[model samples]
Target chain A: MEIPVPRPSEPAKVFHHSCFAMNTRFSLVLVGLEAEQARALAQTAERHLLACERLMSRFDAVSPVSDLNRRAADEKVTPPDALWEILTLCQGYWRQTRGAFDITLWPLTRCWREHLQRAEEPTDETIQRTLLQTGFHRLYLDEAARTVRFQSKGMSIDLGGFGKGYALESVAVQLRAAGVERAFLSFGESSITVLGSHPHGPAWPVGVGNLFSPQDAVHTFQLRDASLSTSGTAPFNAAGGPRAFGQIIDPRSGRPIEGYRTMSVASPGGMEAEVLSTALLITPAEQRAELLSDFSAVSGVEIVYDSNAGEFVPRIEWKYGS
Target chain B: MDLDSPSLSSSGLESRADRREFLKRLAVLAGSSALIAELPWWSPLRVAPVAEAAADRVRLGLVGVGTRGNLHISHLLNTPGVEIAALCDDYDPHLQAGLARVKGAKGFSDFRRMLEMPDLDGVLIATPLHQHARMCLDAFSADKHVFCEKSLAYTIEECQAIADAHRGSKRVFQIGHQRMFSPAFLQALELVRNGAIGQITQIRAYWHRNGNWRNPVPDPSLERRLNWRLYREYSCGLMTELASHHMQVANWFLGAHPVACTGYGSINYWKDGREVYDNVNLIYRYANGTHAIYDSLISNKFYGMEVQVMGPKGTIEAEAGRLYAETPPPAPGIVQLINSLEHGFFDTVPIGGPSWVPDLKRDAKGTAITHEKSTDDGTAISLAAFANAIRLGVPIEGMMEQACRSGVSVLMGQAAMEQQREIAWPEGFRI
Candidate 1:
């Protein structure tokens, strides 16, 4: 039986903020009152002008074309301070994740995209070439000039996926400066950040959607000044439809992830939320506890695994209050 | 810690020993007379030199002095006539802490050493779920009175064996379903039994928690196997730990054992090394056609715990400390016909002997009874009764059976959750 969607009696008052570049699927929620502040943050995020944007944006994806196109075309140009900082930050995160979250993997993504499109299997040689030129170490970032040059000619970079969360966090800081105490900002499907508390009390209530069962909500989280992000095959992946590959790609294996039905992360910062949810998807089930233990920012996590009957049942794990 | 009964206070005694001797004699006379004869006749029996029969002061030996056992200690301290004699816990810190809570109590790491105190009158068992049956049986064999915590045993055989042993022993063996002693629950039970709510048809109970148990163990103390509720071997997961309490409530209200019960549970979250389930939902069918639905979760704290008993005439629901009754809707088609009959349908006949509105507007008699606090004073009341019976050498017929039956009630829910199948109690099975 399909139940009618329960909507609030009154219209929800809208809040605005923007940081990440806007596309059909990816855009920042602007929380500040002035549009110009939102636009400036968006520019900083798009050009990797701040290290917060680049360091925060760490994903192996094919979209967000500017960084990938320039690197692939061998365009060595000076960038802004924020962009340089982000690029340098990604290099560190790459090391910490043991090359599991390298951003310079667009060539490998391209190979998978081509093979997926043609319905053809790639040979070991094709996979090897892409892997060689796809590590964070392959890209030499010049901090003084804010210039990025690939040590190997074929290496490329992209930050379309992770940049939104990094940019969202940057925008949240801007919102805090603007004296916005309570707010929620979302960047497309995967990134969401909460500011302050709900007007009545502490903790903003966010509903956790069941990935397989669209009609049901598993649990609601009370978040205050926390960022929440969800990654799953529910949004974009399709076997024979308009969307063939989902947005999240596993850097370790150079493929879109499967197995986990959904993973939602809650943390103090948007970048942490974005990275943990993506990294959690790629990390095998057995090694997940060790992988998650190191990050102090990961406050809580809820994952739904598919059962024999294809039902998604949630498993919740949370750290004690900080 | 010092007080004389109102009856004894009028007559003066010089020293502590003199007062104790006089009080002991008075208690014995009062206890025997109260049981054998009515209050008028019993009062006179206590008029003579009341200084012969002395009730034993309970020297309580506590085992498993941790989170749960701590609460038991606090309650026992408040209880009159209980002297906490010894405390035992594997963790030295907990043992020291438990010893500090009850002044002058001896502390030991091993429970066996604590139980060896010859003066010990009773043993209070609040160990983890797995050790409950063995500890209680040991205490019983030692000729000590036992007060074991809920979910009395981990397995059906253990529950049955303990019940059998308790039947054979002359000592009092009580299971702690403290809510049974709660005034609100007692009132609710009374209201239902008296047909205030007609016949109860269903009961719904839930204890939903947001996060799974994740208390940090001390570094270098990775004894997850010992604190084994997190694993299947020791605990029956959410069913035994939580649902059993409500199941006992339902069983008591229905006044019959369930014919069959079935449920499902799983490790929905916190897929670490723990094998126990994080969530479970069960349905029990009573012999009298009543049904009880129970559920629990370790993922999110949204719905507070509550027990809603539905009857034909009304619904009695209690959560936390508040008891609310939603009376069934007013009889349908009353107002129109009463007005029509009062006015002769058209105001033509004026056939009114008395105004019908007054009868319809009569006020309800307010609440049946009001309780002032949440602490189960019933336990104190029950303990007083048990002490009276023990001192008088009379049978405590209904109390032990009630607790034993509820222990079985707890086991039924556990078995259903563990085996993933329906369980039925044998016909004519008592306690």
Candidate 2:
């Protein structure tokens, strides 16, 4: 069996430019703009992405997140207004998803990755110890001071799952504010936001592909002035080797969820789409609908892979809304 | 050895370690005072020397109070230990305007009277191209230093004459090629010298603007006087005014002037009875087989302006302050595995991770070469260099040569375009 590669869509009457930022490629496409104006707007959007990266990147030693990791354990630390707002939003999502989505899962992620590197599963005792280091409830937020403190040491936040959506949403807002009515912005291809309808169609057509075979679409979403985000698990390592582990760590189990699966969600808000996509992937098949009820106007689908003979077959395990 | 193409084979550095050692040696060689004296103003050691108390102040006279002259006036006013002693312009309004700006400065309708001021240590000639030769010669005759705006002279003979006269004079002679003082360009040059981009291969540059390339004149009778750039008798338009800056950078980086050049130009878009072409395209070939391709137009501002110095390993977009590696270095584990595989060993590669997803898909967008963002485009720094040189009483080492090479090369290109044939560097002309 041959895997197909996706080709670029037909060129539209849009000014499109791409740049590498925040550990992913970000693209901005503006409809009905001169080349000069489009370039200027793209520059503004790129600056906004860089600012987000500076504020949120865990790898950047000087980033605010890194500073919080270093200091929030012992004392209350007031974050920048932007970061404070994002944290508050994360807190709201955590409660809405009933603890399915958590930023404090970094400890569990680090533990699973280390054990997996040695081709061994983490011990139960190790998992329990690492679990002690995680849990959103251990985080304390002073509403009046806009400051946060960790109840336990090693409790950290990684924006890797949500930063792209936030940045894309920010760029989309800036473009709309600048009178760019029809636009499309995407971060790392996994998170995409559209400003308005397509130039020739009523909505922008976006595909949710099988994680292993990216060109094979499991589902498609028609986004009109909305955003879509996808979270998935893969069997192969980053270097293209056959590996048994995945990137999505189950916060409750303190281990990466084994199997091939992908979840895609769409909503008017970029943050809502990102949170639902990640949370639905971890929530039990029967509990996903209840978790998604907190977000209005959201649609989602879960594609689970079944090994038939020697080939992987993708099946729509569950879906919410059309 | 030709200064344009330094012989690299003699260094015998084949391995990366050896090449790094060779770069270290080159750095030491570049630091010597003897070499620094021959380097351009953009070199690392080209800092302003401490001024003597007695010779700290360098009073200057402005010859043309036009657009470029006014810009120089603004920079000079902010420059330390510099005073605007006289302003000269045949146009009464410009002279009055300059006089109004520089409180106590005297005004002159003719530059010769301005050059006659004993207190004027230097004269900055920002006049039209055709008048540059006469003003520079007169400035030299009056025993005053000269800072002439670029595309030095209208004719090749005039360029040679200016150089020849300056060679015998003790006064400093500088040109208005501000990229020489740009911090970004200097950093780019440092990268090139350190072999960050391997052997220099080619340079591609362009300047594009979507405008008619015209200056508004107060009256129709003063058209030639006000908008001299649009006329053949006074200027070569895009080639002299726009292309000269890129050509100067090309020659400065290549370390050699073009041996020959050929080009074609036309007044294609703005057919407003302008004597010079609105578009130009030229290719200059150096002695070492390196080529610099340049083009300019007034029809599209899409590309704006940039000088891309390319080599085998990477490209340095000097204007944009970015460098892109041809192939980015692989992750550390991948490098080790590749090396082990090449050596016929089967090893368990420790390359497992939470899928090493890149922050962005690596396309052609390269990394920024500069650490901090800057608003400077080198003009302010270039003016400071001029003031410092005058105060230190020493001419910049290669300022005149940079001017002559770019000035003569553009004139050659103009000659090539006008005569419909390839033009060689002027024979027997010495800088």
Candidate 3:
């Protein structure tokens, strides 16, 4: 019989703060501070996070990303300086991942999702048409004009999970510069970043646990000043075998990667972890190693859900060393 | 820590064995945008409790030293800027027991003498329901601030008298409806007020338990004192002891007292010659024609306890700290129509690839109003608020009215059940 799982002992004086931002809840854990001071620092971090969310949230009508998606098709839109840097960084990631990490595939994603919701496949004609509107190469960023323009009409860019990682990295930087030595921030339990080490250990032993049994650690990451992001497809039929409801669309195939699987990646930066987790999931098996080799101190794991077990059982299909 | 669960991801934040904080986080994350006003008394929660000097501490005297009183003592002992200066109980053993917990606290067999101590900043009355009114009036007459426990008083008149005494006083007069300070309740309140559940058309609340509500009495002579909750003279059975908490939440959300109430009661179980009924069911009608239905029994624990606020848009289980929408937001009228037909998500697409169709997932468990998963409830935070209010010398707004509305409402319930007729809310009450 399985014994009740125990949450590992926590260190003293860890103050927590939480707020709703980015259409999601953001939680912060700060250790070894007076409660009042921790609250102040967390509030500051929250402000920084909200600011980043305003810059990137595609759902926010007033957000710069939304403005870009609205006008960049016909006329050039000069993004804010900070956003321009983010766009350039995304372009870098797009090149590094060889288009696997493109953010311009939201139209294709919407198309696939609409068809999949009805348990039907979109026609090849429709996929080909959506393919025209996607691809990061089609979105031009002119360095001299500092303006962004889209090559096709009805094309849109969505930061999606990337926005959460960006917000986390931004807040983490603010905290580290503010002399915060130990902290934990999580957005929607998927994107996580930590500062310094755990109060009781040399590094924070953050574990990826079962969704139903949250304390049962399936895998543990002894992270020191690192971030982890998990990108996955939900099982289309949880009780049935091998069916997947696509979450992250593969920009190359113009369709989502087939199967119920997740890719978890850890890196020194939250944005890198976020980008690589999705990129690695879509990249072919042989190309994954070369894709990850470009980054320092990065590790990746693929957990493929075997639904034949009656209950969806996750098995590690692939692993890459940090 | 586990990165698997949203609730446990940062459970370390509330460092104490505080499931309350955990529940609050759950509610917030589950999308209960807690819209509680940033009241001043909660400053103690945000600010350091021990940082204030001893002179700035609010010295308090506790009158009752029984079950609830000892719970308060445990919280007050840990609360910052508060000192338990005196302990009082007519029962010498209870008084001694309380005194042992707080070193240097003066113990008195008579509560009146403890009220005379000029050093005490406030008095917390956690005595029997019958005694709340007298102690509150005396404490007020003595010019000490008062924090009285729930089910305010023995009768409607006494409830009025206590509120009247605290009316113009500069001192803080807080009624112990701790849900007022509960993070889960606060989150639930925000959802209700924001029209997340739309206009509340009805409310149904229930508290069910299988065991006989009794404390083991040391002797036959002490039965009334130790197990007073089961009696009519000293209490109104489950109504005042347990039902009042839910009543307070309902009244606060409804924003009005029940104009009339009717109920039925009977001593159907645990017939130990107890005067009060073992089971009771009541309906309170507010002026707006909406009704709050409540029921409790000491025979079935199946339903447990819950306060469900329902409207056309959704339903809120306040005690459970969850909100369920009739249709998940962004679901258009046609989607709702499809939902009513009970078609699965994978049903054939009836419309063309349209732009406005929502991506809907059929869900039933409802979103948790975070922090509701806490065993801490709001007792400790309410104690901190009490001490903070004493230090600031400001009364809690609507506290007396909350006390009277729920307090009198229950009394009305008791009367309706006992008298076998509808009982209207007391006319010309001064709360």
Candidate 4:
């Protein structure tokens, strides 16, 4: 979103403006309140103060080269403090999830991307090579110096799963600090974070759009001061595009997440919701409920599975309170 | 004019009449000055008395002990001047436990039956959310004081009825949203109201929890019917159970009722045939053109439990127990001008008939106060205040109607969530 260019002499009230961009496939909103509320939220996103959004900018720098790209020959290997903090957070999550949400699978992702670009499937040998290069335990993080290194040079890290949610969290915190008591940071159709509240309505009226029909919202969610993220194969696979080929890779078998079209989680923080959304989808149908209860951030969850009946069936939806 | 009578001889009659008049006038003057001398210069009307009664000796009774009701009894037993007089629960085990705590106190299943017992003076209601109305009505009918749990009642009609009952009885009635009595909350409220920070434009509140509903069934025959809170038949969900306290706080600070509301909820967890929401988020629009947002979930515990009040002058974070204000000291130029005057530089200047200058007031201090103890002391304080009001016959505002008004906003939030439309405040709504 373009930053609001304020004319100095204008009698400024709050200017509620939203910007749309394709990188994250969502919108950045600046709600110019009577004072500095919107500006504060914007700063939080820009500064990467939030764990979710902070990953996108710096993870790319630290990730191992998927292919030997000459452009990264003299690239700085060490990430900044902010990036290091995020990596540290991810490392802790890796231990917590036991590699369910591993970030060190960029090499496999790249290989799949190459195959998709060529409109062909990867050969067994190529798949085997990519699998060998990806393993959560293979990424070595140096705590003392705050650096990340791969056990094998081919190992890489990509933070695509959790980045947008973290960014929304950062913006929400900024909004709280800036005195904009409530707002919603909507990241395309994938996620939303309620900073404070709505101006004259309920928490926030969220439209849960139909997977088959993206234009129609089949259900609605009332949300406030919480982060809600949805992970689904439908967004990618709708047009059968290259990005859809094998995006949701299963850490267990190193293949696409099968039989799940959409999975959504409500959490107190964006990054927590993002990771859990992905993890819940890839979990076997039976163990999904038990696995979701492990995180305190998860308040409610809705998991949809692609049933053999040619329709997505709601496999599990659990809320915290009765 | 009666000169003919011997007693009315002009000079003698005049002297007699004057003598009588003098005595009567003397009495009148004496009475007037005496009345004037008896009046006090200032009465110093007492709002609350510190030394009126001992806290340990007051007898308390449980009128409708339920979930939060039991919690009240547990806390009250620990407080001074509070002793459980009788146990009044519709169910057996709850009543038994309460009676056990206050051995020998009377036990009655019906609240009115308990009220009729000569020993009871005050009643605490912790019944189903809907029962708050009828029980409070009975408590006030018996001329006993009341302390009803939060979200006071289930509907606006019930809220209004309770308010009328409280008003008609002229008895002390305190709602269970006890945070009102918490020192931190009180401090935060005062700071916001006093504009310590500035004009509060918005407020955010949340209470998130992760769990399933598995209360010990009161009766096997009742089954799901026994746990009324889990169903719409008895309770208001997260809004009533959790958001009520926070919403009341916000409403109190805003000094108004919500103008409108919009929200949504769903039954995603523990769908063991429960009607009340498992998750809810509500936003309220106040008459002052401000807003309050409340959210809660039953499945996750990553709780952001706080009330953030944002204002133009400063921000008061209730959870943090901190008040930040924009008290920039007088600018240096202003300071220098005052300094010059303090040194008698302004003595030669003509100014409003006298050379007057002000000091910097440099000792102004700002520090964040973290509450050392749990602010749950509100329950005790509220009880004490209610007792004091009953004993002293003092007027207490924000009775059941205030609770009802606050509750209506919660219901409105629910309505918004269900209907996906704005719920406007009814015209001439007192609460």
**How many Å off is the CA of B96 in candidate 1?**
1.5
TM-score of chain B of 4: 0.75
lDDT of 2 by residue, B13-46 (tens): 3343432333333334345424254365534224
Misplaced by over 4 Å in model 2 are A1-322, B1-38, B42-55, B335-351, B354-363
Interface RMSD of each: 29.9, 15.1, 17.2, 28.2
Which scores better on DockQ, 2 or 4? 2
lDDT of 4 at B345: 32
Q: What is the Cα-based TM-score of model 1?
A: 0.46
TM-score of each: 0.46, 0.55, 0.53, 0.49
Error of 3 at B396 (Å): 1.5
| Model 4, global lDDT | 0.59
TM-score, candidate number 3: 0.53
User: What's the distance in Å from true for residue A316, model 4?
Assistant: 73
At residue A155, candidate 3 shows an lDDT of: 93
Clashes of 4: 27
Model 1 agreement with the true structure over B304-382: per-residue lDDT tens digits: 6778887766666654433333321211112221232233231111110010111111222123333434333334433
> Candidate 1 docking: what grade?
incorrect
* Count of steric clashes across candidates, in order: 22, 6, 11, 27
Consecutive 10-residue window with the lowest summed lDDT within model 2 chain A: A1-10
* Deviation from native of the Cα of residue B113 in model 1, angstroms: 3.0
List RMSD in Å for every model shown. 25.9, 20.1, 22.2, 28.1
